[model samples]
Target: MAEFKPVKLSSPGHSDDGIAVEVLPYGLTIHKLLVQTDGRIHDIVIGPENPTDHVAQKYTNSIVGRYVNRVPVGTHSFERNGVRGDITALPNESPLVSLHGGPKGFDAVPWTLLTEKDALQLFSKAEAARIRAQPESSFAVFRLESPSGDQGYPGSLIVEVLVALISPDHQQKISENTPQNEVDNRVGSLALVYRAKLREANAVTPVNLTQHWGFNLEASLNKGPETLSVKHHTLTIQADKIAELDSDSLFTGRHVPLTPAHTHQAKPIGKDFPEKGYDDYYLFKDDLQSAVPTRIPLSSFNDDSDFVQDLLRSSDNPERGLRGPPAIELASERSGLKLLFDTNQRGTMFYSNALAKSSAGARKKIHGGSGVSGSGDAYDPHTAVFLELHHPLAAFLHTNEKAGEDTLLTSEELYHNYVRVDITSKQSPA
Candidate 1:
């Protein structure tokens, strides 16, 4: 791990009405997201107090990749170039599963910062326009290259993450030169765009990346004597079908209708949650793209959109290329804070921090800082929730036909997906 300082990003030229963020080079981690709502600034994203603490906290707002979730051991063999080979990933979880890319995944590695010139060369004119439309937005491009067989993967992979903070006032710039119906209305949004390419032409490897950032909306808004937790947060996932999991929490290769407990309809997170909070994958039930107006032309960025489109158009089945809705919502009533999640990934994994222990000792050095105050004590079980967007777990073990398209990429194809978070105040009119 490398020691890096925090890079501050503020929208609207550091005005109080916009969003501010902090980033670190280690793990390409998001240190803080300070959202101003109702005259108060709330730090919606939670992690360790100091920037260096991120090295020990692997998944705390870090870009988790190569493979997002658990992979059953012995299931590493894949057919590439008409020949089958095995990926010998370390068994980090017990002795049967490799949890999070074999221990030292992308989250645990230090990524290099890409120069603005090099980063701009990767995009087209239209994409560059979109990037410039964000006024006073700070852009940080983090690059990471994973060598072939680094973690038993088959090919060398290069990945870049673009973190941008689009202040609320930039809506005017983003909506310019667009039809009234095609405009994007999101405000105070943070865009995290991930792009990857395999270094070898004949090599094949599994690629599913996601950011495992936990959210405690009221972490900085608690002013009363009572403590705040994520139990009071209301959630709504736009999916009716969920992936079935066995006792070990691995995918069972079956789809099950969402039960009442798992199904969310502006429902409070605390009610009907399992003993350890939610850790389930939900499959979308509707066509998200149809409802979402295409803006900025993502296909121009050399992403896997073409491959996914071909799959959607080729298959006669309506569910062949199902994706989550443009936005999944979570709200905190106490703080009057609302978070809207938009992604292009296949599905979402909702995980509440049910098994998290106290962080008071680790956060002791960051108490009473400038932005927000940390309790330096354990809030409770389910203190925060993680909404991760990525391909299905263990998709690398299955073929594209079985796991849908773009689950694994070829040498000629580039991997791209994004998760955008838009924060606003409930007190404001919708």
Candidate 2:
């Protein structure tokens, strides 16, 4: 390994009326919460110097996990050395059900930071593994140990989330000296990384850990439903059949369409328009073909509006062909931490930022006088998408973790799956 440079942490930047923020060298900044003079508690996120190049792609500034977005009860069992332990309901839910490993998730507590070259070690000792995440690297990890009578929940769970800023240099061929015609594998791109470990102190149990990111590609304050397109995107799975939804169109398994279901394969956001949004998941069929590779213009996604067509033409990358099918590599930067699932937890959630409208986005709330937005510019259907790796919430019927004990999920690594994830101007299959 190359010698790592020490991370540079700075003091908080002063704010006139709000909280202050601190910057980190590895493209990270921390926005500590502040109590306003008006008796209001404001939320702040740490970010990198270049929010777009370094921060936005990092998903690190905040630690976002707490039972990490809805979990089903009864879906998980508790055991200690083969002995059955009692389980409880999860807190924070309206109806009460076990969500993110029973409260005290990594994001709920503070973390100790030990920085080294190219890596930051954060440790948390909460009752259960707890952590939070922003759109960039620089996450926190909390830990805890069970003290007594395996009360409502079973065995003790120990989880450690190792977070880092994944800013590896892109080995693309773009150089000052290379002939304009020759290609160099040295393109500069900025990104972040998050990876963690979970173990049961006594027995074997199922564990699931995932990140939550809200993306808006158009830079619209209301996360307008920008255009969208999925090209040459093929989903392959081992299952012959998968779960379907009751009323909604959402699927409950790592759904991928069968080879014959290519009818809806490569399409445009303009094709679907405003009538509906994509908050559903499709099951992957077993014999699916591998994804094709392409860069730059992912796919031409625009409405009949001449303005929309003109916008894409002006910024689209030449390497990324605007014509033909968009190649689908489905690649994400944080290697080795790719999600693998067991049959017990066999679904993936595909959620569009359905709730992030204009004023509802990251904009600061204006006081008094009439503010902007509410003009139908909030969360549109085309801004961005989320491919969550988890099980259906319906599985766990009842859950509670007030026991202040450990409730961790532990499992083995499965297959190696890679997905192409883009944060900038390049095409889909770069």
Candidate 3:
């Protein structure tokens, strides 16, 4: 086992409103996300007490790729050379499926930091020779020359990831006399942007990548009286359909309308935990694109009159409907903490951390200097939730992109995906 060494990065000059982020080379995992709220600081993301524990635990705050979610284990048929052929994938934890790119996937390996300027750029490459030699080990095909017979797939691949954090201008906008309502809206807003690009030309491959960052809005980095479980947090997702899962927890390739109980319309998480904890994929509503005017092009309108009217409306009220409702929102009334998630991905996996355990000495003391001591505590089910954004699992199996389609990526084209997460504080109702 390798020892854990983490590098901490903060905003220039350690601004009070800025966030302190920690990353580990192993898995290029985000170990901590600290932000100031009220008079105290909170680590809203769930993480292991010890950095090395990341390897033993599930993909927490790690970059999962190659294939983001699940694929059938063993040999599976894929399109190659315009003919159906078989490809083998590595299996982990489950014999019937390969998860997060198998046991040795990107989440389980170390990534090199290519640059550290306005954003963090981490690079990992899968060499054709190495991938061919280790057919049983999981490997990333993007941003690498996979070649034919590499991981039972054809062609080479190349991929790149860029991560950036944007903080609000609290110093300039926030003042001592700032209204409580205004301050509530201004403070604690942190934005995380994840952008990925496939860099191979004339190559076609299955590429789905996502970050696994769990949130406990009311939770504290230091064990103290303010620490609260996520049981009381309210959740809302702008999804009307969810992917169905089988007994083994793999998607059954079916989509079902969400029942009232499963609908996340600002409902408390504890109310639904008894009915099988949430580990399902929520499909974003089709009309979500309309919420943003930029996504609605002039060509979408049949007549010049309608197009001109819409253009006027959009320009006259640029910020009017932009802040409607996010794809997902999680809030804790007790701490007045709220988190909003938005993404261009088609699906978001909502996992409630039902399998976490505090036993076996897996727990450790909190980080930072808060004068709070450890109580040998364990996290209960639903104490935290992970929202992973990505395309539908096994989408390549059903997609047939034409040569010039914008959605289709050719050797000269690139696939770019983005997800934004914003953290804010809201005032409790009077």
Best-fitting candidate, scored by lDDT: 1
Model 3, residue pairs in steric clash: 142-158, 142-159, 143-157, 143-158, 143-159, 144-157, 144-158, 146-156, 201-411, 202-411
Q: What would the C-alpha RMSD of candidate 3 be, to one decimal place?
A: 9.8
lDDT, residue 321, model 2: 22
C-alpha positional error of residue 66 in candidate 3 after TM-score superposition, expressed in Å: 1.2
**Candidate 3 off by > 4 Å:** 1-4, 12-15, 79-86, 116-155, 170-183, 188-201, 221-228, 290-324, 367-378, 398-410, 426-430
- The per-model lDDT (C-alpha) reads 0.65, 0.29, 0.56
Give the alpha carbon lDDT tens digit for every residue of 1-430 in model 3: 3325765655421234445667776776778877665656667777677788787665888878667777777775544234333447677758887788666766777665442222211121221222223212111211222244444443454444434444443333468877665544433232332333324434445556788878887666344433435667899888988877777767666669998767988999877565557788887787764332211222232222121111111111111223345778887776676777666666689888777654422433343222122334555556677988776765554433221111222333334455655566644331
Question: What ranges in model 2 sit over 4 Å off?
Answer: 1-69, 73-86, 91-104, 116-154, 166-200, 220-243, 246-266, 273-276, 282-347, 357-361, 364-382, 390-424, 427-430
- For candidate 2, give the lDDT: 0.29
Candidate 1 segments whose C-alpha is farther than 4 A from its true place: 1-3, 13-15, 80-85, 119-137, 169-187, 223-227, 289-325, 359-376, 399-403, 428-430
Model 1 lowest lDDT segment of ten: 311-320
List model 1 lDDT by residue over 300-353, tens digit each: 444322322221111122112224334478877776667777676757889897
Model 1: colliding residue pairs: none
The window of 10 residues in a row where model 2 has the poorest summed lDDT is 331-340
User: Highest TM-score: which candidate?
Assistant: 1
Residue 2's lDDT in candidate 3? 34
